[model samples]
Structure formats: C-alpha cells, structure tokens
Target: MSGYLALLGSSFEFFCLVILDLERFALAGQPHWDELEATLQRLENDPDRGFHDLAAAQRFHYLYQRAASDLGRLASFSAETSLRRRLEGLVARAYAELHSAREARDTRWRPLVWLLETFPRTFRRHAGAWWLAVAVTLLGSVVGAFLVAADPEAKASLLPFGHGEMNPSERVAKEEAGRSKGLANRRSSFAAELMANNIRVSLKAVAFGLTWGIGTLAILFYNGVILGGVMLDYLRAGEGLFLAGWILPHGSTEIPAIVLGGQAGLMLARGVIGWGARVPLGRRLRAIAPDVATIIGGLALLLVWAGIVESFLSQYHEPVLPYWLKITFGVANLAILGAWLFLCGRGPTPED
Candidate 1:
C-alpha cells in the first residue's frame, strides 16, 4: 500500500508538471505544441496505474487526444503549420458562410441557428468579470428599488431626468403610447428594427471588450441606473403591481439576454487584449475562433426571443395573472437560462 501511494504521488506530480509545461509553452511566444502532445501521449500509456493515478493520467490523455485530433487537421492544407493557418482562415470563411447562408433561401435559418447553439459556451467561459459586473448591477438595482420604496421622501429626487411637470411615470406612459402608435402600421418592421438594435448594442458591448472591459462596465452602468430610476418611479406611483405587468411579461428574457450579450463582449475583448500573451497569429486565431462564433450565434437566439416578447407579450400591459403567477413565470425564465449557462455540459467549455 505504501509503495502504491508513493507511485500515485509521483504520478500526480508528474502530471501537474506536464500541464504546467504545456501551459507555459502555450503562453511562450513560440509554443512547443508538438512537445506538449508528445508528453500527453506518454502519460496515457500508464494503464497499469490504478484509481490513485486516474486523475492525472486522464488529464494527460485528454489533452493528448485533443492535440492529436486538432493537429491532424493539417492534412487538408498545403501550407506548413496548416492547422494553425487553417484556423486563421476562419474569419473570411465564417463571414462568407454566414452571409451566404442568409442569402440562400434554403440555408438562411440554419446558419443563424448554428450561431445560437455555439455562442453561449464561449461567452460563459470567457466572461467571468463581465458577468460579475452584470450581477452587481442587477443586485444594486434591486436594493435601490427597495430603498426608494421604503421612504419616498428620502428619494424625492431619485429620478434625475425631467418629465417637464408630467411626473416620471406619466411621461414614460405618454412616450410609450406615442411609440406604440407609430409602430402600429408596421409590426414586422418594428420587430426587425428592435432585433437589429439589440444585436448592434450587444456587438458594441463585445467589441469594446478589447479595451480591458472598462467600456463594457460603462455601458452596463448606464443601463443599470436607467432601470433603477424606472423602478423608483413605478414604486412612487403606488403601481408596483402594474409595474410587474410592464416588466415581468417580457423582461424575463430581455434583461437576461442583454446581460448575456455584455458577457460575450467581455469574452471577445479578452481575446483581443491577449488574455494570454499574444499567441502566434495562427494559434491566436485558432484559439479565439470558437468564441467569436459563439457570440454571433447567441445574439441570433436572443434576437428571436426578443422579437417574440416585444411583438406579442410586451403589448399586453395588463397583469392578468396574480402576483405569484407572474413571479413564477419570471423564476421559470431565469431557471431555464441558468440551466443553459451553468448546468448544461457542452465539451470542456460552453462554446464547444
């Protein structure tokens, strides 16, 4: 038993060293990728080892398998370092594929659906900081709402924007009514317009991620403050129940989707900023391709959902259901999103 334990410890140590070595090479200006693959292969040969050696051995084996499979992709190319170069080729191919898919009558929906399926995992893996920012913003809004609700006098000036004497909520109602009337003639166009606006906003959130994420935070803060002010206004009007009708109907999906878009922006930004040292151009592109695909794909899904909510659900501003029922629907929406984000297993990361 002592000998077995000793062997297990040594094996574990070796396994760690192997991983560190691979990581180091990957971070180094010139990655010794072939060497990493060789090490993984050797580790996997230790079949005689028992449970104690399982963890390290399995890791090495997995890395080795991935490297082998990825490296083998070179057969399709005539260039040296074909696997890496081929990955660099992704930008043009992706753009063309997506564009062509959209233009082709039979293929338009397929490309969009593909993007929806792949983007969440990438965003989830690379968006830790941005996601935290979103969480903080949401939590702050909730707390601020409760505070305003407690003592109206304490927050008499809570809403800073002017309603020109109509009061905040009344102003909003008038504006909303005007917008609805303007949109009455073109429902499909309105949905498309909203979808385009949402996509543009989400893309900007991700694109600015290249700037160390400060830009993303600024955008999120703007949104949070606006929401907090609206909540305060609603509570002030003694219309908490009515507010639920306005928000809970479609906000359940819309709000989360916006947050998710922010997260995707952060992920893309990390790649642009070289989360690890700038990789070989080929290696870098290969590493980040899947993530780019994920962001675009996720936005497509969000647009569809947002269109449904905006066109159908949001128009019905009367809370037909009881408070508990509305709350339940809100909870259910969050639960489904949570399952997709954290619980669902897809490859090693969400994007895969």
Candidate 2:
C-alpha cells in the first residue's frame, strides 16, 4: 500500500493514489515518472547543470524515493514485467544520479569556500596547538634577547645573512643610501628563492612531527631566538624604525606561516602521543592527518606572499620607502591576517 501519501491529507496531486487499482495507479504515476525521467535526462545531458535551489534538489530526492517505491510495488504484478523493468531502470538511474561519487565531490569541494571559510575554521579548531607554538617561540626569543643583552659579541653567531659583524645602524644607513641594490637585477629570482626556502622550512616544521615533536619545537625555538637576537641588536642600535619597517612587511605573514607549520607538527605529535585519547594509534593519526594537511596548505600560500613582499618591498629602505609608511603597511597586514584567522568563518555556515 503506497499509503504514505495519506499524510498529504487530500492534496489534489496525491488524491488518486489513495484508492486506485493497478491500471489507475499506473495512469496516475505515469506523469510523475515522466517528470523524474526528464529531470534525469537533463542532468545527464548537461552535467554541469546542478540543481540551483534547495527546493528543486529536495524534489529530485523525493522523486527518487517515489520511483523506488513504485518499482517495489511493481514487483508483485507478474504480468507487469515490462512496466517493472522500465521503472527499475529509472529508479537505478535516479539513485546513481543522486549518489554518484563525482557529484558528491562537486557538492562538497568549493575552493573559495574552503580558502575563506574552511581553512580558518580548521585553524581555529586547532588553535590551541598554534598558541602553544607561539609560546614556545616566545620563550626562545626571551632566551636569545637575554644572551644578546649580556654579550654584544654573540650577534655574529646569533645572526645570519652577514648581519652579525655589521652594526644595525650602519646597515640601515647603507640601505637608505641605496646600497640595498643587492637584488636589483635579480628581484624575481630572489623572491623565488625566498619562497622556496621559507616553504621548505615550514614543511620541515610540519615533517618534524615524526620525531614526536622534539624537532618541531627545536625549529620553532631556534626561529624565535633568531628574531629576538635581531630585534635586540637593532633596538640597541636605536634602529627601531628600521627594524619594524624591514621585518613587519614579510614577518607579518611569514612568521605566522612558520608558526602554523609548527601547529600542524604539534597536532601530529599529539596524535602520535594520543595521551588522553582512547582510539588506536593508527586511527588517531589518520583522523588528524587532514587537518595537518589543510593547515600546511594554507601556510604555504601565506609564505609565498610573504616571500614576494620580503624581496620586492621589505628590502627597500628608508629614503626609498619611508619607515613610517612601511611600518603602517606591516601593522595593517598583521591586523588583517589576525582578523581573517579569528573571525572570517564564524558565521551560520557549518564549520565542518
């Protein structure tokens, strides 16, 4: 008995189904069958023409269920072989259309949505790990700052790119005097090098989770030490403006990207440790793998942008680009990145 329509309570469309014989039932269902078939044909012919509205998609699912019910009923009528076969085929096609793996992918994967929404949501979901990374880096910075303040000569070993032996004030003077032309003819190549190097470093931060996070923590701490040493050195030289201008443009994004990698690494280590979790180690690792991958992917994009800025903009000094203006740009960039991470995806849309 296809009496489910009784819920409609005398609706004109379903009224005939309440007490119809086989022939009458066939007559009534024929129109709906034709409609479902036509919709399916349209979908097959124009694969990209997905349902445009919730109502239409709902109708399609309802039609599928109805066709399936009709096929089941036809199974009892031995003389209705032709009708049964036709309906079975239609029901099968409708089922495939609704559940096809390709359609499932199309429905779930939206790149822009993932970028602006899903990535932020995922990062927020695992923000504890990221904050932990920040804290570790901060601790390392403290240690590095202490060492630099105590021993001025430590800068040689504490700094890189030949910043050790030279005074920060002298470097700033030279750069402002237009001696920063080191990459003038090779800006593109330098930018590419920065991108590749930074991405590799970030990936290493993530990959180090295989060591149960020890290596990841070390990498993060070392980075913090470098930053702290540089900051203390420049500020000591009364080059605070130069430091802010030089670091902020790229560091605004680059530092966070690296920290994000550390976050992913910590997350992986958490899975490996599974301290409070009751699941099997393998299952735990598998569960967190996607989150790790997503964070890494987002950070890679951030690093690319940071690398470009570092080479093309961050390298230019005071007279060419005012320190105040550069510092303002960096502050703005930092604020934007912070807002995007903290607020972008916290709307009505489902987070997962």
lDDT of 2 by residue, 141-201 (tens): 9988888899988888987778788888888888888875567788899999999999999
Local accuracy of candidate 1 as per-residue lDDT tens digits, 169-198: 664456445543434557677777778877
Model 1 alpha-carbon drift over 4 Å, by segment: 1-120, 139-186, 275-286, 319-328, 346-352
The pairs that clash in candidate 2 are none
Candidate 1 overall lDDT versus native: 0.56
Per-residue lDDT, model 1, residue 139, is: 67
lDDT of 1 at 17: 40
Ten-residue stretch with the least lDDT total in model 2? 10-19
TM-score: which candidate is best? 2
Q: What are the C-alpha RMSDs, in order, of all predicted structures?
A: 15.7, 8.6
Residue 291 lDDT, candidate 2, scale 0-100:
88
For model 1 the TM-score comes to 0.53
lDDT score for residue 278 of model 1: 57
